[model samples]
Target: MKKILYLFLIFLHFSCADAQTFDGSWKGEVNVSGQKLLLVFNLKKDSNANWVGTFESPMQTSLKFPINTIKTHEDSISMDVKAIGLSYTGYLDRDKDVMKGVMKQGNFESAMILVRSENEQSGLSRKQDVFPPYDYIEQDVSFQNAKGNASLAGTLTYPKGGGSFSAVILVNGSGQQNRDSEVFGHRPFKVLADHLSKNGFAVLRYDDRGIGGSKGEVNLATTIDFASDANAAVDFLSKQQMVKTGKIGIIGHSEGALIAEIVAAENDKVNYIALLSGPVLKGDSLLILQSYALGKVAGLSEPALEANKLNNRKLYDILLRDEPPKVLAESLEKELIRQNNGNALTSDMKVKLSPMLIPWFKTFLRIDPAYYLKQVKVPVFASFGGKDIQVPANENIYALQRLHLNTTDVTIKDYPNLNHLFQNAQTGKIEEYFENQESFNEQLMDDLTKWLKLKTK
Candidate 1:
């Protein structure tokens, strides 16, 4: 689910800028997920006296962002990025060395402080540039399926030697993720590809049909339709001379994990499967848990949290009836208004809800993970983060245990400190997502490598 903070950040970035003189590097910090994250801002005054600035997180490049309006009265100054979906209403101190203000993003608001910095900021670069050093060939490939013309584009990493190697295909979770499922300046798939390839496993990861350089409309496709794309990837891997034909498998994360299950159930060519934070429960239940957790983390009031839960349950009830999308959308809007007087959602919320809610909920609510799990003849391994707010670990693990398939070959491990993206953090708040470096847990990666080695042998 897209969080309000993300939308606000986008809005704040594109807002119009007004005249003001801002000419210095400033630094600030916020406590997120129990750890303090450093945020740096560099503002410069142009010849036109317009203030231009860039926002930078630690170890990420400064991204150019415009201020919608800037006002300076003596030493007191203020700026706002209405386009970035963020507004800063604050005052500069008498000494002009500090700017203290409040930042409002959607319904959430917090205080912010900026202090002048004397030295040039370091450790700020694009996340893609952090990929482990490796030699690889980038390629654009396409294949046809029942879902119309579909294409795949990604980097194919190979080991130092030229001999045939064990291979794995990467599958991303929900949303229109690129080949790397890039988020918060991190490319987990690219990191995984480098690490696995260097360890002698040929890896094939590609952009979703409509993402990156790939072709096709993702909105028109369903999960089953996506499974076809994964199937095509498996077929492509099987035909590769450098990939052991009978040894190719899949490693899917979140929603992609479910797609992997469907592919493995239907295809004999796939030899092994790994589910990273895959859900075993129905889609509606998963959403409820996710909503509840997020609300708790954000310190939502009891009445507000209960209202959300009730509305979600009501929405699920309507979905179970398999009503028309239009009717369901109307009903959901009515319910939202009843709960929060139409003030609960922004325009973006209303626009995104219909398309995202109907089809996804319909398919997900009807899916039974065991149906696919029971049909899989290949070995399977699954893992979830104990602190995952998106997918409950206990519920998913219990469902996996109940599968009729050979439980002996199924392994479930939970990392207590990891978040949905497999990064270690003290808390699992979604807003803290962009605050940290993007990297997978070392222990989980080690365990997966070991299991793959054993399976190939």
Candidate 2:
């Protein structure tokens, strides 16, 4: 749910007459949503005689993303994916071309096998992403969030010959994203911005602070800090000659939805708000539910899953204590050790669990969306995917229905079979996000555009 597998690594066997070297084409299948995705990696020696590797996936457009931190010893290899917190360690078989290893990202790791392949294939197709035939004006835009000491850059798309048109700001969910909310080559924000701009609305979708063209440190920032970035965006929009003043709205996805709620509640400048797959539960409850749901989908055993839940609750409780962060981290480390023995947490598990001690996560555990929702008086449109394990549609929809019961101009709709990214999906697994070609669902765009038109008119 938390941008699981922004990058996936699978170690594949290298077959040359000489099995001692890892230079050649390697292929492996990545299992996602009951589908097998072919991942190919090309490893070679550069002119400097150092080993370099590039990754390719049938589902993505980029044929090669360079692999960093490559370390090779006779028959064993290890590497890290550049620009993301992902690492891989694998051992080669002396008798075969096969390599067995685990891919670790954050605290999640999965066992993978690499097979020797002579050729790479690109078979997956994106039937839904809009490529450039410019139905609207699009420009690279930069703005500042002075409070956070960050300069954010993004794409601003609007109808050509605009005259004070209604505008919307697209806010990304958790994790670092670059304007497009791009994952697995699917750019939902790009698709959304294009759709809305063509329909006569202006849209600004920007990179998170410290990512892409944006400049700032994200480690110390919280959701409230991100809301300040949105506030700055509103200021920027107001200054745009083509944007109508006091008519800016926000469409936030996942954690971005929470940030939008915070902004809309406090800032009267946000006229309308759309929450996509937003959590309805308080922070702690949401975390617990997310863990349970994802674990369930991964087919985790009941006892092991319950142990994880207990450990998570204890850790979240520890985060709220009046103690210094160092002290809290120590406490968490001790608890993790205890939990690992009382039950086992795989090496990958540690990668997943380590974030709980961070300041952003601590702040997240203490806040409740209800607190902000009660204060928001603007028109609200909240949509959830029925199969969203991340936010769990029924819980969010019900919570919003109850919270907005007395508030006028609130609409909540659940789209069946759509995943967290709003892709029409099967099983709604995180891996499906990469496998599916459609960016933003067409029905969703229609619903959102229709609502925005009515609200602005």
Candidate 3:
């Protein structure tokens, strides 16, 4: 659930030079597997006269990634978002005043033409976004993850002038995120928190360590370590005046769902949990399945999908090893070559991979939610998106059939057209997330809250 290589939620930042006429925003649409995703580029010259730019998916307005380098020669421009293995080459057409380009990442390629556009954020007028005149009291809060030397920052909301309410903490999935668990301008956590707080439940959602106002590092931490943070949140919530002591719960998404299982099993403070698109399979298997599913959705050929599966399986095996970073890198490089027919690792390839050699990914590679789920004695609600390519429901939920929980208040629901982010989706592909206007699916939230009211009350 780390949202690494296979996940294509992208961001780009570059700039136009004084010599080039690329000082304005450019818009285009790229076709991936019969779906159209709008791509925007914002290029301007900074005070230093430096060419700077940014890429936006008005729909996936979650990232503003920094590019490695941008090179320009006359009307031609090239840049690389090395972090996501994305690169682009474009030439300006004077007559049309458009930038025609080709974007390449791994085995995928698409041609695009960008026309001038003034809109900075499009497809963001969502119906679910919360605004002024709240029925709940929202406040900034913080708590110590003493074990991790972290002071986590969060927003807590509850019904105004209410009794001690049943409380739930929102846990995030993969990738670094703020308190809202925002993805592509979609804040599922914020929307869920708003809805829950209005429904007479206290909700607390926080930034990940080393992200936002939180004062901790996630570089060296594992899932178990994050559970410590969640446990600390439970402790903080349990002591809050507005929270019912015996009614504390957690709502985890993706990787956070695994953390929820760990905390619910180990921490008595948690009375219930809600899992959104959580993985039931072991980490390794989940990642493998994720890759295959993503490939299939992208319309990869059978042979290509098979080759990618074999390649990722080998790389994951290397990650499962406990060797040092250097050793692991060497093994990973060798496997990469073998998987690619002896092709050497390019600099860009290494740049994209350097981040994966860390501890979080390694630990996640072997994490098994079932090991902790079996021990969870609290009330549980696990929901999956039928179209969720990241954590496919048919397979992951099927794995749950093998689980025999100790809690009788368990609830499991599947949304046929929802994606990993719980949005109403067309293809459930990652790229499709930004195109939709809905943040968290209304039906899923309604059902989940109904279940919470029953179990918590």
Candidate lDDT scores, in order, read 0.67, 0.75, 0.75
Candidate 3 clash pair list: 14-52, 14-53, 15-51, 15-52, 15-53, 59-434, 60-184, 61-184
Assess every candidate by TM-score.
0.73, 0.76, 0.78
Clashes of each: 15, 6, 8
Ranking by lDDT: 3, 2, 1
TM-score of 2: 0.76
Model 2 lDDT per residue over 345-456, tens place: 4454445444566667778888899999898889899999987878889887888778743259898889988988898887665656645678889999999999999999
Off by over 4 Å in 3: 1-39, 42-77, 80-123
Residues 1-457 of candidate 3: C-alpha lDDT, one tens digit per residue: 1332122221110112224566676666664543346666677777997777776565455787666667777667787777778778876642123455688779988755565544455444567888868999999999998887889999999998868999999999875567888655567788999999889999999988766788776667777788888899999999999888799999999888989999999889898899988889998788778877766775656886676677677788887887888999899887766755677765544544654676777787788889898998988899999889888999988898778877777788989988888888877755455456789888998999999999876
Error of 3 at 8 (Å): 9.2
| Cα displacement (Å) at residue 92, model 2 | 18
**lDDT tens string, model 1, 157-244?**
7787578999999998876567776654456887777778767898888877765667775555667777888898888788888888
Instruction: Report the candidate with higher TM-score, 2 versus 3.
Output: 3
**Model 2, CA-based lDDT:** 0.75
Residue 180 accuracy (lDDT) in model 1? 71
